[model samples]
Target: GSITHILIFASGASKVPLAGFQGTPTITFLEPGLGQSLPTANTCSVSLNLPMCSTFNDFSEGMALAIACAKTFGIA
Candidate 1:
Protein backbone atom coordinates (compact mmCIF):
# COMPACT_ATOMS: atom_id res chain seq x y z
CA GLY A 1 0.00 0.00 0.00
CA SER A 2 1.08 3.59 -0.55
CA ILE A 3 1.42 6.18 2.18
CA THR A 4 -1.14 8.94 2.22
CA HIS A 5 0.36 11.27 4.79
CA ILE A 6 3.42 11.64 7.01
CA LEU A 7 3.38 13.83 10.10
CA ILE A 8 6.62 13.98 12.05
CA PHE A 9 7.11 15.52 15.49
CA ALA A 10 10.68 16.06 16.56
CA SER A 11 12.08 17.29 19.87
CA GLY A 12 14.87 19.34 18.32
CA ALA A 13 14.95 22.11 15.78
CA SER A 14 15.06 21.08 12.13
CA LYS A 15 17.57 22.66 9.83
CA VAL A 16 14.86 23.17 7.28
CA PRO A 17 11.34 24.19 8.07
CA LEU A 18 8.43 22.00 7.05
CA ALA A 19 7.30 24.42 4.34
CA GLY A 20 10.78 24.67 2.86
CA PHE A 21 11.65 20.97 2.97
CA GLN A 22 11.90 19.49 -0.49
CA GLY A 23 12.29 15.80 0.31
CA THR A 24 8.62 14.91 0.51
CA PRO A 25 6.07 14.55 -2.22
CA THR A 26 3.82 17.51 -2.87
CA ILE A 27 0.34 17.50 -1.46
CA THR A 28 -1.55 18.88 -4.45
CA PHE A 29 -4.97 18.30 -2.98
CA LEU A 30 -6.41 18.70 0.46
CA GLU A 31 -9.84 17.92 1.79
CA PRO A 32 -12.10 20.92 2.06
CA GLY A 33 -13.75 22.31 5.21
CA LEU A 34 -10.59 21.62 7.23
CA GLY A 35 -12.24 18.91 9.32
CA GLN A 36 -15.28 17.63 7.57
CA SER A 37 -15.21 14.55 5.39
CA LEU A 38 -13.11 11.85 3.75
CA PRO A 39 -11.85 12.03 0.22
CA THR A 40 -13.05 9.50 -2.28
CA ALA A 41 -9.60 9.05 -3.78
CA ASN A 42 -6.03 9.57 -2.73
CA THR A 43 -4.97 12.84 -4.29
CA CYS A 44 -1.57 13.21 -2.75
CA SER A 45 0.55 12.54 0.29
CA VAL A 46 1.57 15.21 2.82
CA SER A 47 4.51 15.37 5.17
CA LEU A 48 4.83 17.71 8.15
CA ASN A 49 7.93 17.66 10.32
CA LEU A 50 7.50 19.86 13.37
CA PRO A 51 10.61 20.42 15.43
CA MET A 52 11.34 21.73 18.93
CA CYS A 53 8.11 20.40 20.27
CA SER A 54 9.37 18.75 23.45
CA THR A 55 7.42 20.61 26.09
CA PHE A 56 4.01 19.52 27.38
CA ASN A 57 2.25 22.45 25.75
CA ASP A 58 4.10 21.85 22.50
CA PHE A 59 3.14 18.20 22.59
CA SER A 60 -0.45 19.15 23.20
CA GLU A 61 -0.36 21.48 20.23
CA GLY A 62 1.10 18.76 18.07
CA MET A 63 -1.57 16.31 19.18
CA ALA A 64 -4.20 18.89 18.46
CA LEU A 65 -2.90 19.38 14.97
CA ALA A 66 -2.80 15.62 14.50
CA ILE A 67 -6.36 15.28 15.66
CA ALA A 68 -7.48 18.13 13.42
CA CYS A 69 -5.77 16.55 10.45
CA ALA A 70 -7.29 13.19 11.25
CA LYS A 71 -10.72 14.71 11.51
CA THR A 72 -10.18 16.61 8.27
CA PHE A 73 -9.37 13.35 6.54
CA GLY A 74 -12.22 11.58 8.25
CA ILE A 75 -9.83 9.20 9.96
CA ALA A 76 -10.78 10.10 13.53
Candidate 2:
Protein backbone atom coordinates (compact mmCIF):
# COMPACT_ATOMS: atom_id res chain seq x y z
CA GLY A 1 0.00 0.00 0.00
CA SER A 2 1.13 3.49 -0.78
CA ILE A 3 -0.05 7.07 -0.36
CA THR A 4 -0.45 8.69 -3.75
CA HIS A 5 -1.47 12.11 -2.45
CA ILE A 6 -1.78 14.38 0.60
CA LEU A 7 -4.32 17.09 1.46
CA ILE A 8 -4.51 19.43 4.40
CA PHE A 9 -7.50 21.49 5.52
CA ALA A 10 -7.96 24.86 7.26
CA SER A 11 -11.29 26.30 8.35
CA GLY A 12 -9.88 29.83 8.37
CA ALA A 13 -10.41 30.43 12.11
CA SER A 14 -14.00 29.29 11.64
CA LYS A 15 -15.71 26.70 13.79
CA VAL A 16 -15.26 23.26 12.31
CA PRO A 17 -16.72 20.13 13.79
CA LEU A 18 -14.55 17.11 14.36
CA ALA A 19 -15.38 13.99 12.41
CA GLY A 20 -14.06 10.50 11.85
CA PHE A 21 -12.31 9.81 8.53
CA GLN A 22 -11.60 6.43 6.99
CA GLY A 23 -9.67 5.23 3.96
CA THR A 24 -9.18 1.79 2.46
CA PRO A 25 -5.56 2.30 1.59
CA THR A 26 -2.69 1.50 3.91
CA ILE A 27 -1.44 5.05 3.46
CA THR A 28 -3.59 8.01 4.53
CA PHE A 29 -4.57 11.02 2.48
CA LEU A 30 -5.77 14.06 4.37
CA GLU A 31 -8.58 16.38 3.18
CA PRO A 32 -7.99 18.21 -0.12
CA GLY A 33 -9.04 21.72 -1.05
CA LEU A 34 -7.79 25.09 -2.36
CA GLY A 35 -7.39 28.18 -0.22
CA GLN A 36 -4.91 30.70 1.14
CA SER A 37 -1.44 29.33 0.48
CA LEU A 38 0.10 31.32 3.32
CA PRO A 39 -1.92 29.54 5.96
CA THR A 40 -0.85 26.24 4.46
CA ALA A 41 2.71 27.44 4.32
CA ASN A 42 2.54 28.37 7.97
CA THR A 43 1.16 24.94 8.76
CA CYS A 44 3.92 23.23 6.85
CA SER A 45 6.46 25.37 8.64
CA VAL A 46 5.41 23.82 11.92
CA SER A 47 4.84 20.36 10.46
CA LEU A 48 8.59 19.61 10.48
CA ASN A 49 8.63 17.00 7.69
CA LEU A 50 5.99 16.14 5.12
CA PRO A 51 6.54 14.24 1.89
CA MET A 52 3.59 15.70 -0.13
CA CYS A 53 0.25 17.39 0.35
CA SER A 54 -2.22 20.10 -0.73
CA THR A 55 -4.42 22.46 1.26
CA PHE A 56 -8.01 23.69 1.04
CA ASN A 57 -10.21 26.24 2.84
CA ASP A 58 -13.64 24.98 1.95
CA PHE A 59 -15.06 21.71 3.26
CA SER A 60 -17.13 20.70 0.24
CA GLU A 61 -14.38 21.42 -2.23
CA GLY A 62 -11.86 19.59 -0.09
CA MET A 63 -14.10 16.55 0.19
CA ALA A 64 -14.76 16.61 -3.56
CA LEU A 65 -11.04 16.60 -4.28
CA ALA A 66 -10.48 13.76 -1.85
CA ILE A 67 -13.31 11.74 -3.41
CA ALA A 68 -11.91 12.26 -6.88
CA CYS A 69 -8.50 11.05 -5.81
CA ALA A 70 -10.01 8.03 -4.12
CA LYS A 71 -11.93 7.14 -7.29
CA THR A 72 -8.87 7.57 -9.46
CA PHE A 73 -6.87 5.32 -7.15
CA GLY A 74 -9.62 2.65 -6.93
CA ILE A 75 -10.15 3.33 -3.22
CA ALA A 76 -13.51 3.10 -1.56
Candidate 3:
Protein backbone atom coordinates (compact mmCIF):
# COMPACT_ATOMS: atom_id res chain seq x y z
CA GLY A 1 0.00 0.00 0.00
CA SER A 2 1.05 3.63 -0.48
CA ILE A 3 2.20 5.80 2.41
CA THR A 4 -0.20 8.14 4.21
CA HIS A 5 1.36 10.84 6.42
CA ILE A 6 4.41 11.90 8.37
CA LEU A 7 4.40 13.34 11.91
CA ILE A 8 6.90 15.03 14.23
CA PHE A 9 5.93 16.12 17.74
CA ALA A 10 8.09 17.04 20.73
CA SER A 11 7.43 17.19 24.49
CA GLY A 12 9.24 19.10 27.18
CA ALA A 13 8.67 17.66 30.65
CA SER A 14 11.36 19.56 32.50
CA LYS A 15 10.10 22.09 35.05
CA VAL A 16 12.18 24.71 33.25
CA PRO A 17 10.46 26.45 30.39
CA LEU A 18 12.91 27.21 27.54
CA ALA A 19 15.43 24.78 28.91
CA GLY A 20 13.04 21.91 28.67
CA PHE A 21 12.14 22.73 25.08
CA GLN A 22 15.81 22.71 24.13
CA GLY A 23 16.54 19.41 25.79
CA THR A 24 15.55 16.03 24.43
CA PRO A 25 11.86 16.30 23.57
CA THR A 26 10.60 12.91 24.67
CA ILE A 27 10.26 11.73 21.08
CA THR A 28 7.62 9.22 20.02
CA PHE A 29 8.95 7.91 16.71
CA LEU A 30 12.59 8.39 16.00
CA GLU A 31 14.25 8.81 12.57
CA PRO A 32 10.98 8.89 10.61
CA GLY A 33 12.64 10.78 7.79
CA LEU A 34 11.16 11.86 4.49
CA GLY A 35 10.05 9.16 2.02
CA GLN A 36 9.32 6.90 4.98
CA SER A 37 6.03 5.07 5.40
CA LEU A 38 3.52 6.26 7.98
CA PRO A 39 3.08 4.64 11.35
CA THR A 40 0.12 2.59 12.50
CA ALA A 41 -2.68 3.89 14.69
CA ASN A 42 -1.17 3.89 18.15
CA THR A 43 -0.28 6.12 21.10
CA CYS A 44 3.31 7.04 21.91
CA SER A 45 4.43 7.54 25.54
CA VAL A 46 6.49 10.58 26.42
CA SER A 47 7.61 12.33 29.63
CA LEU A 48 7.75 15.84 28.20
CA ASN A 49 5.68 18.67 29.65
CA LEU A 50 3.31 20.96 27.82
CA PRO A 51 3.87 24.68 27.58
CA MET A 52 1.57 27.41 28.89
CA CYS A 53 -1.97 27.04 27.64
CA SER A 54 -0.83 23.59 26.53
CA THR A 55 -1.94 20.49 28.38
CA PHE A 56 -2.50 16.88 27.43
CA ASN A 57 -5.72 17.99 25.78
CA ASP A 58 -3.92 20.59 23.67
CA PHE A 59 -1.18 18.19 22.77
CA SER A 60 -3.62 15.64 21.46
CA GLU A 61 -5.29 18.27 19.36
CA GLY A 62 -1.97 19.36 17.93
CA MET A 63 -1.11 15.80 17.06
CA ALA A 64 -4.27 15.55 15.00
CA LEU A 65 -3.36 18.72 13.18
CA ALA A 66 0.10 17.43 12.36
CA ILE A 67 -1.34 14.25 10.92
CA ALA A 68 -3.64 16.24 8.70
CA CYS A 69 -0.75 18.31 7.40
CA ALA A 70 1.23 15.20 6.59
CA LYS A 71 -1.67 13.71 4.69
CA THR A 72 -1.94 16.80 2.55
CA PHE A 73 1.32 15.95 0.76
CA GLY A 74 1.77 12.26 1.59
CA ILE A 75 5.07 12.99 3.32
CA ALA A 76 5.64 9.31 3.80
Candidate 4:
Protein backbone atom coordinates (compact mmCIF):
# COMPACT_ATOMS: atom_id res chain seq x y z
CA GLY A 1 0.00 0.00 0.00
CA SER A 2 1.05 3.54 -0.60
CA ILE A 3 -0.06 6.77 0.97
CA THR A 4 0.54 10.33 -0.12
CA HIS A 5 -0.46 13.79 1.03
CA ILE A 6 -0.02 17.37 -0.10
CA LEU A 7 0.00 20.49 2.03
CA ILE A 8 -0.51 24.04 0.85
CA PHE A 9 0.14 27.11 2.97
CA ALA A 10 -1.04 30.61 2.10
CA SER A 11 -0.84 33.85 4.09
CA GLY A 12 -1.31 37.54 3.44
CA ALA A 13 -2.22 40.87 4.97
CA SER A 14 -4.75 43.50 4.06
CA LYS A 15 -4.39 47.29 3.79
CA VAL A 16 -0.63 47.18 4.03
CA PRO A 17 1.19 50.47 4.04
CA LEU A 18 3.72 49.58 1.33
CA ALA A 19 5.43 46.72 -0.47
CA GLY A 20 4.00 43.92 -2.58
CA PHE A 21 5.15 40.34 -2.28
CA GLN A 22 8.46 38.73 -1.42
CA GLY A 23 7.97 36.03 -4.04
CA THR A 24 8.52 32.36 -3.28
CA PRO A 25 9.94 29.53 -5.38
CA THR A 26 6.51 28.51 -6.70
CA ILE A 27 5.47 32.12 -7.18
CA THR A 28 8.69 32.99 -9.01
CA PHE A 29 8.16 30.11 -11.36
CA LEU A 30 4.43 30.64 -11.84
CA GLU A 31 4.68 34.41 -12.16
CA PRO A 32 1.22 35.61 -11.10
CA GLY A 33 -0.86 36.39 -14.16
CA LEU A 34 -2.49 39.75 -14.80
CA GLY A 35 -5.96 40.51 -13.45
CA GLN A 36 -5.24 38.02 -10.72
CA SER A 37 -6.60 39.13 -7.37
CA LEU A 38 -5.13 38.06 -4.08
CA PRO A 39 -7.04 37.40 -0.90
CA THR A 40 -5.42 40.32 0.81
CA ALA A 41 -6.04 43.93 -0.08
CA ASN A 42 -4.15 45.83 -2.78
CA THR A 43 -1.59 46.98 -0.27
CA CYS A 44 -0.91 43.66 1.39
CA SER A 45 1.57 40.79 1.44
CA VAL A 46 0.46 37.26 0.62
CA SER A 47 2.42 34.04 0.91
CA LEU A 48 1.84 30.38 0.08
CA ASN A 49 3.83 27.46 1.39
CA LEU A 50 2.53 24.59 -0.70
CA PRO A 51 3.84 21.07 -0.46
CA MET A 52 3.51 18.21 -2.93
CA CYS A 53 4.74 14.69 -2.58
CA SER A 54 4.87 13.75 -6.26
CA THR A 55 4.35 15.59 -9.52
CA PHE A 56 6.26 18.62 -8.36
CA ASN A 57 7.39 19.61 -11.84
CA ASP A 58 6.53 22.73 -13.76
CA PHE A 59 3.13 21.43 -14.75
CA SER A 60 2.19 20.33 -11.26
CA GLU A 61 3.70 23.44 -9.82
CA GLY A 62 1.61 25.56 -12.13
CA MET A 63 -1.53 23.65 -11.24
CA ALA A 64 -0.77 23.88 -7.58
CA LEU A 65 -0.11 27.58 -7.87
CA ALA A 66 -3.40 28.15 -9.60
CA ILE A 67 -5.29 26.03 -7.12
CA ALA A 68 -3.64 27.75 -4.20
CA CYS A 69 -4.23 31.18 -5.66
CA ALA A 70 -7.83 30.53 -6.47
CA LYS A 71 -8.55 28.83 -3.19
CA THR A 72 -6.94 31.59 -1.17
CA PHE A 73 -8.09 34.52 -3.25
CA GLY A 74 -11.23 33.07 -4.83
CA ILE A 75 -9.98 33.51 -8.32
CA ALA A 76 -11.59 31.13 -10.76
Give lDDT per model, in order: 0.37, 0.29, 0.35, 0.35
lDDT of 2 by residue, 1-76 (tens): 1122233322111222254223221332333334221212122221212123343334335444543444433225
Ranking the candidates on lDDT from highest down gives 1, 4, 3, 2
For lDDT, candidate 1 versus 4, the one ahead is: 1
Which candidate wins on lDDT? 1
User: In model 4, which regions exceed 4 Å deviation?
Assistant: 1-44, 57-65, 68-76
Q: Residue 44 in model 1: shift from native, Å?
A: 20
Look at candidate 1 and give me any clashing residue pairs. Answer: none
Name the top TM-score candidate: 3
Clashing residue pairs in all predictions, respectively, total 0, 2, 3, 0
Tens digits of per-residue lDDT for model 3, 25-71: 35334242343233222223323222222255654555556455534
Model 2 residue 13 lDDT score: 16
Every candidate's CA RMSD: 12.0, 13.7, 14.6, 14.1
Least accurate 10 contiguous residues by lDDT in model 2: 41-50
Q: In model 1, which runs have C-alpha deviations exceeding 4 angstroms?
A: 1-53, 74-76
